[model samples]
Target chain A: MERVPVLKIGDILLVSIQIDMEDQVALQLQEDLAERIVATGVHGVIIDISALDIVDSFVGRTLATIAAVSRVLDAETVVVGMRPAVAITLVELGLSLPGIRTALNVELGIALLGKRDVGDEPADDEDEDDPAAVTTS
Target chain B: MERVPVLKIGDILLVSIQIDMEDQVALQLQEDLAERIVATGVHGVIIDISALDIVDSFVGRTLATIAAVSRVLDAETVVVGMRPAVAITLVELGLSLPGIRTALNVELGIALLGKRDVGDEPADDEDEDDPAAVTTS
Candidate 1:
């Protein structure tokens, strides 16, 4: 399949990805996304990867790099739409995309964008009762 | 520090994170986010994690679960803002965050969401030139 296109949303730019992200492609996408984000002066970014099937170390590293550069651009980033099987595989393979923000879907991610704005506070749902959340590391 | 708050943009939501993301917390967050997405009907989501110390298998799985559930809710998901040191550490530690929608920062993650309405056309860049994109498997 072809690479995903870049689109603009109000003040935030969106980078939609729809293929197995490899090392080089991930790098190119990151560079291009960074440039576009800079051009638009968008502070928030959302990456849709609902179509990706496999992910490797190179792709993982590229993601980390993208986050790093986005910071330089004074923009925040989020990843959305990960597949369950892929998630399992990545975990089984012991692959990690460290320091990356993730959400269940784009909607929630966007809500998180302005979490403090108007949406309901991060309630202490039964799930939110994770010991880790309260523990100090 | 406390778990990052959920950000709310005009039509998007961004959630900043800075934790090692254990399975329990990850799963809880994903489900909660998914529910919120369905309720609010937001546009996109952004997960920012510029301060993660470690990642493990469960964490990856929880992220993947969130991605899949988000899609079912008809919303997109993206993961963003990963650090290089953490990326390498995950790999070395045999840890992975599962393959899902991903970005480097909140800027790009939001951008991905912005373009969803415009129809994210997969536009291959120079990176697609890599042999990896053309996987035999």
Candidate 2:
């Protein structure tokens, strides 16, 4: 069983799921993520699922649970890199994963978490210089 | 044909859908809503779906489309008051209504819009006094 790696970038935790996850793996990832969040006291979580081509209900629920748990621990979760097909399928399958924020890619995901953490600062100046900034809109 | 009333409250447009909408009605509401958003230049929209017991894919797609349209027009959309069963059914059916924000009730929905519109203002003082502020967490 391969464990999902949760990388820490500044105050955010980055989890990039690069494989098609099994039910057990999904659950384990959820558990591991929650523990990591508590231990690190991160203010944000960015989940990059760009590699996932399909998401069944179990996977979808695990994602939602991760977001919910992170929120309870005072961290924001931004799911990014969802393919268009996966999004259409998720909606077609009736699991909108409410309460979870999404972005087109990891860069935007980080920007979202950054924005949330800063609360009211003027939009990041760095965003204006990067093409990825436009992706948030 | 019953028309969904789109009420203007301050700078936000409030829509309360009281019926299980027909496919045609949903489409009509979408058209009507886009026109209203463009015309009013409102910064936010709160859709009250508390009266809806069931939301099929057609209706779900309509909601997503409405959110997409609003975003393009520079307005934020929040769908409020979804019952737990409806949510479960939606996820089971595979329609997560991505890109659409949701709140537990109308008041919180409005606050979500309020927060989005203000961008950097101090958290709503009223939120501190109301128990509902805790719900965002």
Q: What is every candidate's alpha-carbon RMSD to the true fold?
A: 19.0, 20.2
lDDT of 2 by residue, A24-130 (tens): 87888888888988898888898877657788898898899899999888888999878899999999999898989998866677777767534345333564355
The TM-scores that each candidate's chain B achieves against the reference are: 0.69, 0.82
DockQ of each candidate relative to the true complex: 0.02, 0.01
Question: Using Cα atoms with residue i matched to residue i, what is each candidate's TM-score against the true structure?
Answer: 0.43, 0.43
Best by lDDT: 2
The TM-score leader among the candidates is 2
Q: What's the residue-level lDDT of B125 in candidate 1? A: 36
For candidate 1, give the DockQ.
0.02
lDDT of 2 by residue, B1-137 (tens): 65565655457776666555778778888888889888977878878775577889988988899999987687889998787999999999999999999998656777787776354444344633566555454
Please tell me which predicted candidate would have the highest DockQ against the true structure.
1
The A-chain TM-scores of all the candidates are 0.74, 0.82
